[model samples]
Target: MATYSSNDFRPGLKIMFEGEPYAIESSEFVKPGKGQAFARVKMRRLLTGSRVEKTFKSTDSAEGADVVDTNLNYLYNDGEFYHFMHPESFEQFPVEEKTVSDAAKWLQDNAECIVTLWNGRPIAVQPPNFIEAEVVETDPGLKGDTAGTGGKPAKLSTGAVVKVPLFVQEGEVVKVDTRSGEYVSRVK
Candidate 1:
């Protein structure tokens, strides 16, 4: 295994600690008048999404994590797990619900995503920033209501509910910002 010294600590650097993989969220170097320099690091565990902080001496080193990011297409879900397939390699894997909860709202069949792998198994998934979904159900918009003034909750085809302007109606396709789960605009 490869090792990275405190000098190499930085955001986005992946390392192995306590037998698990972690991504360095942030690292700061601190030097005192009479003490040895150290690096304070905040890292998030790849499998559980938990964060921890630790201080390491300037000469301390950590093993590099065997992590990789791969592009995959969303396949069908069977309740327990969400399946994905690599476009070129045709590799398929099942991701647990807890690992995908954050991105579940934006998931659509055949959608493209980036899957983070640790030791060749999935640890996290990232969906596209924006998605276009059709409204499946929502109350009727008042005749005179405009798109700017007010909004109502609408159910989408993907089963995620989002607030849409009053003018949006059932069966209409709208663009949504996946990061915020907010309505962007009506799809033309």
Candidate 2:
């Protein structure tokens, strides 16, 4: 296995700590005037999605984790697991609900997603940054409400609700930012 030193700490770097894989969310080097310099790291556990902070001395090093991110197509969910397949290879992987996390809200059949694997097992799933989904339910747009000023909550076909512009009507396909769950624009 490879190893990473404190100097190499950076966001998205995967390392093994306490026998578990953690992806570094942020790393800051602190050099005080009193004693030694250390790196403060904020990382998220691969399996649990929990965040933790750790301090490492300048010379400290940690083993590199066997983490890989692959492009996969979203399949159907079987209640217990969400299935995904490689576009070319057609190899399928079943991921747990906890591993899919918040990305489940944006997932649709045949949607492209990034699946993070740790040691050949699915650890996390990430939907595309932007998705176009049809609005399934929302309050009726009032007459002459084309100013796009106020907003109303609209439920999408994928079971995610987001605030849409006043002019947005139900059954319209709208582009959404999955990361922030914000409405982007009405699709043509």
- Best candidate (score: TM-score): 2
User: Which residues of candidate 2, in runs, are more than 4 Å off?
Assistant: 143-149
Candidate 1 regions exceeding 4 Å error are: 141-149
lDDT of each: 0.92, 0.95
In angstroms, the error of model 2 at 51 is 1.0
Q: Against the true structure, what is each candidate's TM-score?
A: 0.86, 0.95
lDDT tens digits, residue span 105-161, model 2: 999999999999988999999999999999999999887776655889999999999
Q: How well is each residue in 56-146 modelled by candidate 1, as lDDT tens digits?
A: 9999999999999888999988999999999999989899999897898889999999899987889999898899999999999988776
